[model samples]
Target: MLAKAIFLDIGGIVLEINWRKTVEALGVFDRSQQDQIWSVLGSAKIHLELERGNATPQEFFAFVRSELKLSPEAPLEEAWNQLILGPLPQVDQIFDRYAGRVPLYALSNTNRPHYDYFMKQFPVMKRFDRILTSFELGHRKPDSEIYMAAATEVGLSPSEIVFIDDSPANVDAAGRLGFRSFHSVNSVSATLEILQRHFSN
Candidate 1:
């Protein structure tokens, strides 16, 4: 089957992210401070809400400051954007090769601040025809609504598009919806093989 569009996840697929980098940079100087950070911000309820676009960046920052007793020394962007590292070289080549040939889009679970920082820091991401983020769409990956919206955004049935993500849950979610999804955590060559199987190499 030929894929008319491609949906890619940003965090682990296109760029490198160290999730713990946030707590570390935000000055987790002690065990108690670390515990406080994880207990509150890392909590499923709070963190999921943040990813699902319920809380704005400022709101999350305020919650962190108030709950974690963080000083006002560091910039809020730094704390939140700490996870973002750099681009994946092979992924960049993949995008450059298939960008205009196929309609490439980003379907990521991320908040507003993270989205803005990524676009600004990695201008190459602008090549995507569209970027559907959780913050903008008010839904996260593995959700039926988001998957449907992605199909709509690409103007194709789920089977007509290919979704690549590092999360197994997300891959399974896409597969359930009949999307030609692939798990991308283990190897880039493997992902390339999946794409080649569905599209002209």
Candidate 2:
């Protein structure tokens, strides 16, 4: 079946964001203690709260800093923004390869600071037909609500959309909703291969 719309995750698929690097930069390493830092570093509920527009990045980072026992004036603000190092190397090529075939959308689970920082710093992603983030939609991935919203944004049914993400759980969630989902682990080329093999023909 051909995908009428393609929804891709940003941090890992379209952008090379080293969330761990940001956590390490904050000097938080222990797994037990890393819980607080992990929330800001990975797909945790606290991070989702920020992406859901419940808390500003400043407020989120302030909470992280307080958990780490760092001063409010500490230079960790830049660390969160630094999570987005740059765009994925194959972004332009990938988009160009599939540009007019179907509407492409950024269905990311990210917050405003990181999103705004990347939009200005990495203008290449503007090529996507739409930008749908948890911040704007007020729902995160693995939740059927977000997937349904994405399908709505694309003006297609879940089965008509191909959603790709690096996380197996997210992919599984989308698959359960009838999407042609791909677990795109660390390679855009591989992601394209999956699309071509599964959805394109």
Candidate 3:
């Protein structure tokens, strides 16, 4: 049985960020342009900069405008906000049930602006026992260092913990490092089941 900790991935696991839905709602750009925009936005450099708190929404907007050759009329911030379209209401309840009963953590490969935006928008989001962001860590998922750091910070053997993430690569990485891991599809229901089974010990 897993004895020590539980870690969650914030993006799709706790909060749903549907970039495609958001861009469509923004209505200024078509699917093709949105795809291009995501290509640039999801680049390692840009994402790392965001995680480090080195970039602001306005700054990202400016960068996108310049790169896409678009005019200043785009609603970048608003469109970005659209990504967090639906907040998972049951998220806190799950944490509440298990936080002190077992160690709980949040690990994400998110940039600064989105991190700030999430905190400001969702007070309940900050309830994790430990919060690890890639930008802040200077290391993102699928990298062993970040996982090592998380386990170290929590003071547990990697074998005693389980890591949950929306990415297969991340799940596999954690698995290789001896963490029990789950790919966070159908997150709340599936995760709660895993936690219940593990923590029942």
Candidate 4:
């Protein structure tokens, strides 16, 4: 089906993130310690709470410091911000090819700090017609509520929108909701091809 609009994911699709980098930045060099730290930081509950706007960034940092036994002066915020490496390669091609053809929206599960950091650092973000973040909406991906809310906000049925995300679960969730969804798998070129194939006309 021809898409009336497009929803793209940010973290893996538009940007590259390294959880290990954040761990290292936090001064954790031991492999096992890094794994354990990342596991805690990346847990579904903690991530969901933060991205769902249920917890403030200050609360998150404080929890991390306390749980990880970090020094009182540890640069928690700075290191956490390091999770976003930068934009992916050739991401511009997606906008270059599809912008103005249809509404392009960014749908991401991100907290305030990372959202602010990426928005400031990446000029490409300005290309989206709108941005829908979990933190802003109080819902995260793989949940029907967020996708339904997004569809409602865009004034379209799920079937009319093309949703692209790197997470298989998110793609499946959108598809189950009747969205024309694609799993980008961290490849901008593949996402572009899918858009071109379905929406190029």
Task: Candidate 2: give the clashing pairs.
Answer: none
Off by over 4 Å in 4: none
How much is the lDDT of residue 16 in candidate 1?
80
Off by over 4 Å in 1: 29-36
Tens digits of lDDT, candidate 2, 70-175 = 8877778677776677877777877887777778888988888888788888887888989999888888888889999878877899888888898899999999
**Model 3 accuracy (lDDT, Cα):** 0.77
Per-candidate TM-scores read 0.90, 0.88, 0.85, 0.96
Best by TM-score: 4
lDDT of 3 at 67: 69
Cα error, residue 115 of model 2, in Å, equals 0.3
lDDT of 2 at 3: 63
Q: For model 1, where is the 10-residue window of minimal lDDT?
A: 185-194
- Put down candidate 4 lDDT per residue, 16-67, tens digits, no spaces: 9888889999777999989987787798476679999999888888888888
lDDT against the true structure, per candidate, is 0.80, 0.80, 0.77, 0.88
- Please, what are the lDDT tens digits per residue for candidate 1 over residues 91-162? 666676787788888899988888888899997788889998877677888888898987886689998989
Clashing pairs in 3: 50-111, 50-112, 51-111, 51-135
| Residue-wise C-alpha lDDT for candidate 3, range 1-201, written one tens digit per residue | 546888889887889888786567556467788897677767736555666556655676777668666668876666666787555757776777886788778988877667778888887677777788887776788889888887887888788988888899999999999999888763687778877877863
Predicted model with the maximum lDDT: 4
Candidate 1 backbone collisions, by pair: none
Of models 1 and 3, which has the larger lDDT?
1
Off by over 4 Å in 3: 52-59
